[model samples]
Target: MSRRNHTDKNASGDPRKRTGAPGVSAENGDGGYNAGIAVFSYIVGGIIVWSLIGWGLDYLWGTRWIVLVGALLGAAGGFYLSHMHGLTSSRNPAGGSGAASGPSEDGNSNAK
Candidate 1:
């Protein structure tokens, strides 16, 4: 295969007039490495945040069980959060109406 020239020009003679990236869209697809990492972070982050809170409470109250409680709470919270915003969610990740949005109130189907 031949290499593309670095200074390739478009019909308008502007090399910088490029559109979106070939395959790198801002939209999120279902079930991939991104989803996996997001879910993992949700669970692990929950555990760490809750555990630290629990530990702080335990230290302040001179007790040894608050940390455990915090950890449990964190785990539960994280799981809940992940579930609500996980890959299986029906809601759009981009915060738009849903799917293609199917036209807007201005009545312009082709308007961005």
Candidate 2:
């Protein structure tokens, strides 16, 4: 006598696959989106904070060029920090096994 092996199937008679989830696409799973956001925030925050400081100095010392210098310095520092972050993250693809992981302060999943 011959036997048959039965498999799980969908309503369409196709074998059921265990692919990921239903609606969640696998695109951008490499952390590029998060990195972009982080880098952008760094740049903006650096500019705002440093520019304010420069503006304050200008108000006190009565000079305009200092504000430009401060803005430039902020931009350079922001880019450098972003680059360092990229290096660290690349070194640990799994995003470090230590603390300060998981959902961020905004409650968004860090895995994204």
| Top candidate by lDDT | 1
lDDT tens readout by residue for model 1, 9-105:
4446666754222232224345456666766777788889989998998999999999888889888887786666544355455777665655556
Clashing residue pairs in all predictions, respectively, total: 0, 0
lDDT of 2 by residue, 1-112 (tens): 9753343433355555422222223333334556667677777878888888899999999998878888888887778877765521444446676568656786655555
RMSD of each: 11.9, 19.0
Clashing pairs in 1: none
Q: Whose TM-score is greatest here?
A: 1
Judged by whole-model lDDT over C-alpha atoms, candidate 2 comes out at 0.62
Name the lDDT of candidate 1.
0.66
Q: Could you give me the TM-score of model 1 versus the true structure?
A: 0.52
- Runs with alpha carbons beyond 4 Å of true place in candidate 1: 1-28, 88-112
